[model samples]
Target: MRKRLSAQIAARRKQQVPADLKGMDASLMAMLDAQIGDLEQRIKGVIEQEAASAAKARLLLSIPGIGPVSAAMLIAEMPELGRMTSGEAAAMTGLAPIPHDSGAMRGKRAIAGGRRALRHVLFQAALAAASHNPVLKPVAQALKIHGKPHKLVIVAIARRLVTIANAILKTGIPWQPQPDS
Candidate 1:
């Protein structure tokens, strides 16, 4: 779009402009193009930073629903997971559903809080984890059997991941996803 606009402006410049003014316009166009190039470089730098995040994500990937992006987001955004309880961090990730209860009639469980982006990645990872990670399969299967919605089961796994990640971060250990006997 910028290229097209630049070309259009150049076209107008050629049609209605003195020779002196044309030189000035060309300079301005060069400056604008330089700025645009700089902006593109900055954007690349920001995207590269995701690698640092992805590194942490690698650890989480071992457990269940947590790939590089999700892991990176959690590490970059929630690096303090080490300070929180497994469950607390899990709840913070919004993996745990909110309990909606009032008087005689109790309300159904619903998800309320969490890092939605990280949650998304976690669940995406969970789908893959459920198939390969022996430990996550049964839990996923059970949730499926109970008619816990597919998304919910993934969220449940995500919650469990927070717990595990927290523990690992705090303990300086990797996750040990054991097989279900």
Candidate 2:
């Protein structure tokens, strides 16, 4: 919606529209942004209001790339986070790779099922982690160095992120980089 509004504003400008008409999209975009900010704040407040959720949110936020929004989404969408195993957590978010195989033929793997919105949020988190996370950074780089496609790399990172989140929540431990082996 924001991108479409931006495009509309650009198109209107290109067409040399009247000043008032030109301002409509910009005003609407500003309104949208403000509303989004308000909603995010409300989400944060709700998460903090609950003891269990606040703890989970804190653990999630401890991860390098998970911000308040991502933590809220995970807590809300996947309440089973701490109880599930790494593979279960990944599968719950649709970040797990599903194998496609046939008699004597192995097809490519792909992710499917699980919470769609959560999967998208996790992907965004993984993208950030791929860039800024100490542990995940090397894993992402190695995949790229090995010729993995960008989306594939991000999916793999997302899967790992879920696994890490699960372990952290289960053990009630905040994320900490492990020593190099």
Point to the candidate with the largest TM-score.
2
lDDT (C-alpha, whole model) for all candidates: 0.69, 0.87
TM-score attained by model 1: 0.63
Question: lDDT per residue, candidate 1, 57-140, as tens digits?
Answer: 555656655655555567756877778887788777787778888788789888777777667667777787777666777888
CA lDDT for candidate 2? 0.87
Which structure among the candidates has the greatest lDDT? 2
TM-score of each: 0.63, 0.87
Model 2 worst lDDT window (10 residues):
1-10
Tens-digit lDDT track of model 2 for 88-155 = 89888998889999999999989999999899888889999999999999999999999999999999
Clashing pairs in model 2, backbone N/Cα/C closer than 3 A: none
Candidate 1 deviant stretches above 4 angstroms? 1-58, 179-181
lDDT score of residue 120 within candidate 1:
68
Query: Root-mean-square deviation of each candidate, in angstroms?
Result: 11.2, 3.5
